[model samples]
Target: MWFFGFSTTNPRNYWIIGAIILVIILTLILKHLAIYLEYSHKHNQEDDESERYKGSSKIDCSKCCSGAIRTYALEELKSATRDFRIRIGVGATSVVYLAELGDGQFGAVKRVMEEKGGSKKMFLDEVSVLLRISHPNLVGLLGFCLDKGEQLLLLEYVPNKSLFDRMHTRHGQSSGTLSWSSRLSIALDIARALDYLHSVADPAVIHRDVKSSNILLVNDNHAKLADFGLCKLGHDIQSAQTPTTIKGSLGYVDTCYLNTGLVSPKSDVYSFGVLLLELITGLKSVQGSTTLAEWTEECRKNKNVEVMVGMLDSKLKGDVNVQQLHVLIDVANLALLENCHGRPDMNYIVDRISSCMEPDIQPELPV
Candidate 1:
């Protein structure tokens, strides 16, 4: 048979055919050897990693993890999420989908995108933190799946959306404005949750990212802190400050943590202060012209109580109690103090906010 002008009758054609066969044989052999080596290397790496994971004290109790937290198969999660069809939330590192689990309960499945900040270390860190901590105001971890190159976290579905969207609603439209009491309640709820994390937890956790967007709301407008990917365990309260890469949103990052690489609960306190500012003024922590912190400082410097009052979200329609506004402003100012140590702790914050909720007392704005 003749192929590409090469015929068996010609000696040169025979040589050419022989060379083509030799090249094909060599290519097949090399490809097979490479595949075998890659497989062997991957198997060894996975074995070593598995051994390390088994010995890790951070997630030591496999029984607890398996029993307390459900581990869904990759195929199951895919089916529940409809191939990630219904996206409820998105962030730099992950995409969250609203899923209907087989058990008939709804869940928010946060799928880690490989190209984003979804490093193996971060994924495990988040899972480790979520596995141990449980509080009413903190988002509950229902389950997780880390198989078949997929990293997903199944969380309690909070229906009312985030505090950010509620507090910073666009235009003049009102989707049931958060009453002053509701705002205070949300603030107190978050404060207690943070206090639990900072003091009550065994090793303690620092919620490195404590922005308003991370605060989710239930149907009743109750606040629940979500997103634990940036959480870090503090060795102890006194020596909580540890050197690490700066991780947090702008406008809310503690200046001390930014300037010095040390991360402590105080860093969270600073961010909480910004959150308080957002709740009180109904302005973003970072405004277009300046930060909420800077704006508040300016108002404080000018001693202009009217300017401060005027800054309250117009959506309230003059319904905000003066006493509550004053208390919120005071708390926010303390939280926004330049010195991290000067910021009030979460317990103190919760106390002040709770006291503000009292019906009888009404404090006038200070001169």
Candidate 2:
């Protein structure tokens, strides 16, 4: 019954093996402790930053913390919003009211409904995300209110409303028809916004909702991406994908994401592609049961320029430059590819859209 290896049979060998195992365990424990300490330190720093604004009504606006978020009292917000009576927009989990803040500037106040657990989580998530990001094409977060069991966000007021209202509302009901130049410019603005989120932000952001309805137009018709409730941070732009509950608009959600429950920046690209199609065709992303993407797939697949041209928005029929329209269609097709990995990045999309606009032609707003 003698073992071939002395270490397997000897008592001294057993002790040595036990010591080795203990050392390995200790090393792992120490390594994990260090990681935990590092994370705690980072979390504490964020907490300190947040504590600066907690229960405070005024923004610092100091050089060190410029554009810091403010905390508003429940009564203050109620007063600013005129008792939340002036409704400007409504959504599934929130209602937006136009407000006149203490500074006398107009703002949009979004009051989150407390009926669902997910809405509470979304309110916190939006605050976390908005605090870290800023861009010309991103809606600015002026402040927030978390008093008296209410979750409210005060944001910059974009007077011109959303791109969806501008593009899809029935004639005589819409603000006005968006000219081709305006559409091109708006597309470019949103592309730049996505480019900023995907490439420039420290940890790239994925605007999980990228439909026209989430795009607000400014006085000049430049687009600003809004609704950060579903946004996610991607640490690695190339391969980061988060498994999350499917939450996005019906017509704009990416099919791959919808099927797999895995979302990435490419999902945003797919939604943006659908938006481009909407801009070009003047049709809802979902009309009846048919998707705009599906409706245009045949012409896009066959490269039938004539068919694509004929599908242009009626209002834009005579105004669009054929060359620019072709460029937009090509970009949209690339973005809507079945394989998420094949879609072009936002930066590339920005460049392609820029090429469509001549340097000298200024974007004309709806009259």
Candidate 3:
């Protein structure tokens, strides 16, 4: 029907059409409202969790970017750690205590030093960054305690201590040297961790400090990267350079970062190369003024496999497979390349290291 026919159409038909259009519009509005409410609720829940742990109005959780992290009362943590009596480790910025929580879950509690604004910032940064990430090879943060000016971070307890302790003597106890294959596997674990931080993480992350002491071992002696107070975020892996104050362990710090005050995932690659040198030679990163990188470069000049193998730990003298030594040297070279662009990314390092570990016989697990 034409215009006149439409005007003459049934009033019931017009009413039905209007009602259908109204329903469609209302449906869309309700869907949008639901989405917004869900988002707000998630944020509100995170806020409530923060408030529950703060214990007082003076402690503002908004001061820090705490997203989905559980907060524990100071007394609860004290009880878990037996009044902080089980001191398992001591570091420059924090003290580590082995904690047994109420839920029967064992964890590590790191009591951060908040002696100054800088130290406080480090604690907040660690909490903020760690909350955003979760990877098997990366240490997991379970919760935190912000009470009495004490900032405590609760973490998954790694029973085997650190790779450094295993590689070197500590407390006059011979922890025994890591097998050649074990070393390769540990390196692979660390590489995979870095790969996740560098590429897989949304907005990415730079481990700023990559060293033997920061690499913890689980029950199976599998490695997990720890200590994220020094981590920095990046928009993407390729454009990850961020100008910041130079911060990292001495020997492992990238020369490029120091020279330019710029940090990136490549800086971590350089540190990983130094770590490889430590693993290959069983040497301290810095023996007096000489760094592992310098020593490795000097060894490279000789261009001799036996000379390189000579750098392997004396304990591993006859134990290391020749093929493994070659693999380590090749990866070390690529990672230690002077040009940042020349250094292979963590993904490449993981692949190369994985190949080296292929021939290894995995240690049997108990039933």
lDDT by residue (5-121, candidate 1, tens digit) is 688877779888888889999999999999989977865564354233221122222433343677877877777666776677788799997666533346788999889969888
- Candidate 3 clash pair list: none
Ranking by TM-score: 2, 3, 1
- Estimate the TM-score of every prediction: 0.76, 0.78, 0.77
Kindly list the per-residue Cα lDDT of model 3 for residues 72-187, writing each as its tens digit.
Answer: 88987887776786666667778898776533346789998866333777888888889899888898887898898778998877777787766775421255667777777788
Task: Indicate the residue-level lDDT of 187 in model 2.
Answer: 87
lDDT of each: 0.77, 0.79, 0.76
Writing each residue's lDDT as its tens digit, candidate 2 over 171-229 gives: 21245678887788888888888888898888889888898878898843487889898
User: For residue 250, what is the lDDT in candidate 2?
Assistant: 79
At residue 185, give the lDDT of candidate 3. Answer: 74
Model 2 residue pairs with clashes? none
- Number of clashing residue pairs, candidate 3: 0
